[model samples]
Target: MSRQIIKDFVYYFSKPLPFNLLRKLTGENFIFPFYHLVADNTPIHIKNLYPAISVEHFKNDLEFLLKNYHPATINDVLAFVENGKKSEKPLFFLSFDDGMRECYDVIFPILKQKGLQSAFFINPAFVDNKTLFYKHKISLIIEALKVTKENFLVSELMVFLDIFSANNKQIIETISRFKYSDTSKIDKIGKILKIDFESYLKKEKPYLTLSQVLEMQDNGFIIGSHSNDHPKFREISEFEMQNQLGQSFNYLNKNIHPQILSFAFPFSDINVPFSFFQFLDTKIKIELSFGTSGIKKDVLPKHIHRVPMEDNLKNATRIIRSEYAYFLLKSIFRKNTINRQ
Candidate 1:
């Protein structure tokens, strides 16, 4: 069976354990849970990418975390890392990626009401709706293709994508596989589909604006860089990676002026080298850096891995339980902690 299927099977059978007990069994006192966005209605730019956690589900997650774990702040994380600070209960640090507008419009009020603090990671290039991420462009293109009944248009799109014999599913798979370096092709796909991403950006205002980010910062929420334009770091060269971090951190310092210099890898931190962390330490002097390698430890003391809460469309309860269960399973084979080259 596939690894995911085995994990699903384990999670299915592991659901009987109480959530608190499951957490204790994992022997991890700190957890970082992260999300892209939460909404009552799924947005077109994110619909095809992954399931957006509903507002109600997000609230339930907060309630569960608050009950079982202390909500940790950026300062708390720093103290824990620097001084081995301990709490009576385990700490859970919540964060959101992509700087989506729902963060301000929908999520902020709920967090405020609950009296919780979290981090927000943003791409400098996409802030203020100035540009759309290339992945979002693919989503818009796919959405457009769904409504298009004209066979000639489909034929043209297939020809342009060089998948002239592809079906709807294959076309979407091809478009979804378009890399960050394939932005030009994505733009061409948008043109062929008559989908104006700029128009969508103006109308939807999909990303959090500069003012919103600043306000969130003022209200005790941590703001961090998520690279300049959200590229997969492994695919880019070391020079490009440095440039991305430098430009984004420069933007953050100039615009947001956040007290903490933090970052979360755009896609992931897999295959990232140990030298990169050393560069971050000596050059960038980043306070914290995160990756989406769920429920694992990292060799670098300052680089932490976060649990992606949106997987399998599961809520925080199931997701957290499954993560803990998976961590234990990996431990048996000594594969739980991530080691950088």
Candidate 2:
């Protein structure tokens, strides 16, 4: 059976029964769920790649969590780390990534209404509309391809990617594999597809401005660095990685006053060198960092793993239950550690 088939089987067959029993037996307590964006009307083409949800669904998610789990803040997690206080109820920390503009216009209002706190991790280069992430450029290009009957050399594009098929899912996956350092090629492809990111940035203003970030900070929300630009750590050299972290911290320090200096890895934190964190220690005091690898405990305690809520939105309860169940199973087999580097 395929992985998805197995995962679906686990999600459907065992959830809320065997899942609950496993959780109770294992004594797992906290979950951190993170998202990329929230929108009431997201384009269908980019939905899978970027993963956004409507305001109504987001509210439903929060209400579900509120009923089943205690919503915790970054401060609460830090306190747990420093003083080791465990919660009596299941705890959750909500986080958003990529610093999209919908965060300010759509998500913040809902969060305010619910009296909840969340952490927003941003790419400094995209904050002031200075530049856009290459992955987003891919999203726009794919959207353009859906509409226009343009005849372009998709095979030429495929040369840079590991993919062989030209299906939409594979296309997005291939686009996702584009190197951050060499975004010029994607930009060239965008130009050929008549999808201009500069125009999009000016017209739509899809990212949060510096003022919006400050307002979020003023309202007691947390802001953390994603990077200067969103790059995969494993693909870049140590010097480039340090520069990305340093420049991002410098930008956030100069603009926003976050109580804790925190960060969430862009793309992922897998295969990252141990020396990277040690280097960050010398430059800045990062209170916490996060990665998306479900409920696994990090060897570095400050580095927390957050579950991605984008997928399995239709069956939130079942999905979360299965994650806990899977955690218990992995713990038994000694396969729970997601990051050894």
Best-fitting candidate, scored by lDDT: 1
Off by over 4 Å in 1: 83-88
Per-residue C-alpha lDDT of model 2 across residues 4-59, encoded as one tens digit per residue: 45556666656547544655655667778888777767843345374567777877
- Each model's TM-score? 0.96, 0.89
lDDT of each structure?
0.87, 0.77
Where in model 2 is the C-alpha error above 4 Å?
1-5, 16-22, 43-45, 83-86, 152-176, 338-341
Tens-digit lDDT track of model 1 for 1-341: 77567677779778888877877887787899999898988999998888888988998988888888888877789986775433445999999998899999998888878878999999999999999999888888888777788778789988887886678889988888999999998998888777888899999999999999999899999999999999999999988999999999999999999889999999899887788888888899998999998888877878888999988578788788778888878888999877877
